[model samples]
Target: MRKMLDLLSLKLLRRIEIRYRLINSFLLVSMLPLVIAGIVAYRESSSASQEKVRIFAAELVKQVAQNMLQQIEKIESSSEELAMSERMQNALAGYYSKNPAERAAGHGEIIRLLLENYGSFEYVNQKYVLDRRHRIMDPQVFAQLGDGVARFAEDAPDMKGRPYWDVYSTAAGQNSVVMLRDILFKSNNRVAGTLFVGLRPLHFSRIFESVNLGYGSRMLVIDARDGHVIVSANAADGNAPESGLVVAVARNVAEGRDNFVSYRDGDNKQQLAAFAPVPHTNWMVVNITPLNALNTEVRSIRNKIIAIGVLCFILALVLSFIIARSISLPLKQLVGVMKATRTGNYLIRMDYEGRDEIAVLSQRFNEMASKVHQHNERLEELVAERTRELEQANHQLEALSATDSLTGIANRRRFDEALGGELRRAVRSQKPLALMMLDVDYFKNYNDRYGHLAGDDCLRAIARVLRTSSRRATDLAARYGGEEFAVIVAESDSANAMQLAENIRNAVAALQIAHEDSPFGCVTCSIGVTAVQVDEDMSTDTLLRLADVALYQAKALGRNRVALSDPAGATG
Candidate 1:
C-alpha cells in the first residue's frame, strides 16, 4: 500500500511540473509583449488615418472649386464677346426703331449671329435675346425663356455692359444659372436689351460626381451672395440633397473667409467642413465629411488589434497544453516500456505517433526490444529476410526509373538503350531485325477535342495494345515520345514485320475510341515498318531515320495504314 501511494504521488508531481513550466514560458515569451505592441500600434494607426482623411477632404474641395472657376470663366468670356459685338449693338438698336421692316431685318441678322455661335461654349445649353418690351425674336428661344426673361430684363439693365449670373427656376421647374449680359447701343453707349445664356446645374454637380469622399460626405456649390445651395451631391448615393453643413460654411465664406471648420450638428454629430471660393464669382465649393466615419475606421482597427491579441492568448494556452501533454505522456510511456523490458518483457512497445525527436527515440527503443525477442529464435532467418527486403527495394527503384509515368511502358532513355543492345545483338548474329514506329493520327487534334486527362487515357490504351502485340520474349516495346511508340522485333523478315504492324493497327482500331477529328471516325494509328539485315555499316540511328521516313509516308497516304521503307542505300 505504501509503494502504491508513492507511485501516485510521483506521477502527480510530474504532471504539475510540466503544467507550471508551460504556463510560465507562454506568459513571458508571447502574451505580455503582444499586449504592449498592440496598444502602441493601434494608437499610431488611428492618428495617421485621421490625418489622411483631413488631407484628402481638403484636396477634393480645392479641386472642385478650381473646376467651378474654370466653367465660370468660360461663361464670362462668351458673355464679354457678345457684349462687344457690332452686329449685336445694331440688332439691339433696331429693336426700338420706328419702322417695322428694320425690326424684321434686325431679327434675321441676330438669329444668324446666334446660330453661328451655338456650339461656341460647352456649358451653355440655350441662348435667349430679350428686349425692354419683353419681346423675344425667336419662337424656339421664347418657349424656353420661362420667367427668367422678365427677371433678367428687370435686373440686367442696371448692370450696363457687365454680366450678371443668378440661379433661377425654368418653366420646366428645373433650376439653372442664367448669365445675363447687357446689350448696349454703340451710338449712345446705353443698355438696349439683355442676352440670356442658361447653364445647367448638372454641369457643376458632375464635377464632384467621381470624387469619393467616404461615407455620409457631401459636395455643395453655394451662392456666396445669399448662402443658398446652387448644387449639392451626396457622396453616399450620388444624389442631390436639399440642406446640409454647406449652408453654415457658405455664410462664413461669404464673410470673406475661406477655411476649414469642425463643428457639431443638430443631431450632436461631429462634422468637418471645408470651403474654397470660385474665382471671379460669388460661388463657393464646400466639402462636408462626418468625423464619425473616420472614427468608425479607427474603431475597426482597434477591434482587430484586440481580437488578434485575444486570439494569441487563446492559441498560447492551447499550444502550452498540447506541448505539455505531448512531452509528459510520451516520456511516461517510454519509462513504463523500459521498466517492462528490464524485467525480460521484450515484446513491450510505445504507442507514440509523432515525428519529433521523442518519437524517434521511442521507435528505436521498440526496435531494440523486437531484436532482442528474435535474437535466439532465428538469426539466420533474420539475415535472409533483410536480404530479400533489399532486393525487392532495388527492383522497385529500377522499375520506376525505367518506366514511363504516364503510359506505363519503357521511357525514352530505356528505349534508346534497348535499341542499341538489339542492334548490336542482331549484327553479331547476322539476323534480321525489324523496327516499327507508330503514331496516333492527329493526336494534337484529339487532345483539343478531349482534355489532357482523356488524352493520357488514350495513350495508355495504345501502350497496352503495343505491349500485347509485342509479347515475345525477344521483342521490345517502348514509348518514344508524346503520342509516339516504337517496337523492335528480332528474327523477323519484311513479311513478318508487316504482319505484326497490321496486327497492332487492327488492335487499336478495335478499341473504337471516338475521334471526330480523324477521317476514320475513331481513333487509329499510323505504323512505319522497316526490316534490315544487320551489317558492320548499319547503325541504330540510320535504322531509326528509315522508320521515320516510312511513318511520314503512312501519314501522307491518308493515315490509319502501314507503310514500308526502303533500305538506306538501296532506294527505288
Candidate 2:
C-alpha cells in the first residue's frame, strides 16, 4: 500500500516538474489560472443548458396535459348533456314496455333526437346506442361490436338504474366512450329502461390535436382495456404493447397526477422523448424532441469555448517557444533521449544530473519508458481476452433471445423481427407473404389431464412437426406463446399457406399423441391462414393483426377446423 501511494505521488509530481521545466517561466505560471477559468466556463455553460432543456420539457408537458384534461372534460360534459336530454329519458322509460325490436326502435329515435339537438354528439367516427338485449340499434354501429357489447349487458346488471360509464369501440375499429344514463320515460311519471349515449374518440382526438406543440410531438388516446392505441399522430399505429411507457402514463392520468417522463425513440438514433398524462381519459401526450435540436444552443457554445481554448493554447505555445530555449536546455537533451527511446534505443541516457526537479523528471521519464513498454504487452493480452469473452457473451444473449426454451423453436421476438423483414422484402419483390397461426386444440385440457410435463412433451412434438413441415428456407415456424405457434411462409399465397398448415396438422396427427380428454379424437390443432398481397400500404403490424383475428375466428368456429379472414377485412 505504501509503495503504491509513493508511486502515485511521484507520478503527479513528475508531471508538474515536466510542465515547469519544458514550458516558459511566465506561461507556466499563467496556465493553471487559464485552465481553472476554462473549467468554470464549461461547467456553467453545461449547467445552464441542462436547466434550460429540463424547463422546456417540463413546460411543454404541463401544457399538453392541461389541454388533454380540458378536452376530456368537454367530452364528458357533452356525454352528460346528451344523457340528460328529454328524448333519452322518455325512450328509457318505455324500453321494457315493448319487445327488444321495439326498444331498439325507440332507442334509435332518442339517439336521433339527441344528435339533432346537440351536433357535437353526432360524428362519423363514433357509434351511439342503447343496448338492452343481445341486439344493438345504431345507424353507424359496427357488426363486430354486436357480440362484444351484448356480453357487457350481462356484465353490468345495475346498468338499468342510473348513469354509468361504459366504454366501447366503433365498428370502424375506433374507440368509443359511452355514458349509459338511466331513462325514466313516464306518460304517468314512472321508470322505463336505459339510454346509452357515446362520445367518440375522434371528438377527443380533434380537441387533443388542436393543442400546439413542437415538431414530432404527439397526443394519443389509448384504450387501457386491451392496449389499443385509439388516437395517435406522428407515430407508427399499432395495438402491441412494445413498452410499458404508455400504460404507465395512462395510470398517472387516471390517478389525476400530471407527471413528466423521458424515453428513447426506437425509430431514430438521436431522438429523446418526454411524456405526460392527459387527465380523465386513457390518454397520454408525449413530447418528442431530437437531441440535436434540443442541444443546438449548447453545442454552439461548446464549439465557441473550444475555439477560444485552442486560440489561447496556440498563444501560450508561441510564448513558451520564445522563452524556453535556455531554461529548457536540459529538457531538450531529455527530449533527445526520449526520441532515441522511441527508435528502440532505451539504452540512451538524459544528460542532466543536477539535484533539481528537472533532473528528477528526467530520471522518472527513463523509468517510465521501461514500465510503459512492459504494460503495453500485458494490456494487449488483457484486451484480447476481454474481447473474446464479450463476443461469447453476446452470442449467448442472441441465442437465448431468439430460441424458445421449451420447444427449441424460434421465439415470438425472433418471429416478429424476421417475419417483418421478409414481409418488407416480399412486398418490394411483389410477392405474397403468407402467415398461418396455429393453436393446439384443447391443450389446456391436455395439461389438466396429463400434467404440465406431459404438456411440454406435447408442445415439443407439435413444434417438431411444424419445423419439419416448413422445410423451405423461406419458411419460419415460431412459438407464438403458450400453445400457439405461427409460421411465416414468404413468397406464398393463401392457398399455399393453407396447404402447408394442413400438412403440419396431419403430421401432428400422425404423431398419434393420444389425449383421452381431447375433444378432437387425438391431440389436434386449429389453423388460421392469412396472406398479405404485395402493396405499398401493407404494414407488418396490420398483417399480424389480421392473422391474429383470423386465429380467433378459427377458435370460435369449432376448435379443429381452419379459418381464414378476407385479406382486406378489418381486424378486431
Candidate 3:
C-alpha cells in the first residue's frame, strides 16, 4: 500500500484544495470521541428505562397469575361444598349398593344433585365421578370420554384424597383441563367417590378477556404438571405456521419462579419475558413483551446519535468528493468496465481517448478482456459436453433404482407403478389384465439344506423364465420380494394367463437346479394366475390378492404346479 502511494507524484497529490483536505481531516479526528460520549449517555438512559419496564412487567404478570389462581380456587371451594353436602354424600355411598333398584336410584340422584349444585353439564364434555372401587359412576357416559379418562381414574387411588390436575387435547380438537378431587364422607372422614371436572379451553378465555396487552405481547398459562399451555393470550395460534417456535419458547423459559428474562420470540423480535407461579396449583403464567414496545426512550436516543453521525459523514463525504472528482471520473469508468467483464461480458471495453495513466490501463484491460472472451467460448463447449455426460449418468442411476439388483427385473416399487398405469390403460382400451404370483416351492428348506447363495441362484434362474414369458410391451415382470415374483399381462384372458403360468412352471422345473430338500429333487416354483376383465371397480391390490390366493393353493396341493383362480377367487 505504501509503494502504491509513493508512486503517486507530489504534483498529483497537491491538485486537491488544501481547505477541503483540512476540513475532512478535522471531522475524522473529532467524530470518534463525540460518538463515544453519545453511546455512553444512551446506554445509561436505556438501562434505566429497561429496568423500569422489566419490574413493571413482572408485577403485572404476577397480578394476572394471582387473579387466575383465585378463579381456580373457586372451583376447589365449590367441590368442597359438594363434599360436605349431606344429600350428595348419601347418594355417592349408595352408588355402590348391592340392590339393583337402589343403585339405579342413587345414580339418578347423584346426577340430579350435580346438575343443580355444580354446573357439571356446562362442561364441553360431561364431568365424571369415580367410586372408591375405581369404577366410573356413570357407565353409559364412558363412551363419551375416552381412554384418557380411564388413565386419569387409575391414578385417583394413588392420589389419596388430594387434588390432581391434568390437561389433554380431545378428539374434538378442543383442549380440556381435568381436575380430580377425592370427596370424603363426613361420618367417618374417610374417602368417598372422587369428583372429576373438565374445564374447556374457553374457560381460560375469561381470564384473558380483561387483559389488554399491546401488540407483540403474549401470555400463556402452562400446566406445570406437564409443559402444555392451557390457555394463551396475544399468543400464536396453535395451528399457525410459527406454532413450533412459539411452543419451543414457552417450554424453553424457566418455570416455578417470578423472574424476568430477555429472549427472542417467534417473529424474530426481542422480548422481555416474566414468569409467575400460580399459587397452590401445578401451573404458571408467562408474559412476553416485545422489547420494541418498551424501548421508546432508547430508540429516540439512538436516532439522535445516528442523525448527528450522518450529518458529520455527509459533510466529510462531500468535501472529499470535490477534492478527488477529476481523478475519480476516469477511474470509475474503468471500474464499471471491470465489473461488466467479471460478469462474463468480456466484449465490453472502456472508451478512454486521453494519453494519461488511465489510457494505458484501459489498453491493457481491453487486451485481457479479448483473451478471456476466447477462453470462455472454449469453456462453454466443454461444459456442455460434460453436462450431457452427467445427464446420461443420472438416467442410468434412475433405471438402476427401479431395477431389482439380483434378478435385473422390475422391483416391487416399479411393479406397483406399472400395475396402476397398466390397469388404467387396460380399462380404457377394454382389454383383459392378468396377474400371476409365483413363489419358489420349499425355498426356505432349500436355503437351509444348500445355502443362501444357492437359493439366490435358483430365484435368478426362475426370474429369467418369467422375464422371457412377458414378451409384449404391455407386460411387466417384477421380483415382488424374496423368492417371490409377479407379472402383469395386459390384453390377455384367464385361458392365456393359465397357459403362461404353466409354461413358467415347466421352465423352472427345466432349470434342474439341485434342491435336495425338495420332494421333486430339483428347484421348481408354484405359479398362481388370475386374469380379470379390466373394470373400474377392481384395484391393483384386488388382482394381486386373487393371484396370491391361487398361489397358496398351488403350494398346498403339491410343490411344482400351476393354479388358476377365477375373478371370484375360487382356485382351480
Regions more than 4 Å wrong, model 2: 1-328, 331-361, 570-572
Which candidate comes out best when scored by TM-score?
3
10 residues in a row with least lDDT, candidate 3: 239-248
Best by lDDT: 1
- Which window of ten consecutive residues has the lowest lDDT sum in model 1? 235-244
1-572, model 3: which lDDT tens digit per residue? 44544333223544444455556556664567556777787778777867776777688778889888787888778877877788878887687687544676778788777677656346444476777765667644535464556666775446655676667555677667777888888888888787877787667756777775553567777755444677776445452323333444456554533377666655777777666778767677777667776666666776687567667677666545544554576688899889877677999988875455666788999998999899999999999999999999999978987888889999987999999999899889998889999999888788888877887787788888888988998888999977889999888999998998888888888889888878899988899988888678778878888898899889889859988876774322
Report the Cα lDDT for residue 400, model 2: 80
User: What is the Cα-based lDDT of residue 394 in candidate 3?
Assistant: 95
Q: What is the TM-score of each candidate against the true structure?
A: 0.42, 0.42, 0.47
State which candidate, 1 or 2, has the greater lDDT.
Answer: 1
Winner on lDDT between 1 and 3 is 1
| Candidate 1 runs further than 4 Å off | 1-50, 119-123, 133-135, 139-145, 152-161, 205-217, 225-228, 232-247, 250-258, 264-269, 309-572
Error of 3 at 503 (Å): 1.1
User: How far does residue 294 in candidate 1 sit from its true spot (Å)?
Assistant: 2.7
Q: Would you list the clashing residue pairs of candidate 3?
A: none
Query: Which regions of candidate 3 fall more than 4 Å away from where they truly are?
Result: 1-322, 335-344, 353-368, 371-375, 569-572
Please give, for residues 435-454, the per-residue lDDT of candidate 2 as tens digits: 88899998878888898899
Q: Residue 304: error of model 2 in Å? A: 35
Against the true structure, what is every candidate's RMSD?
31.1, 18.7, 17.8
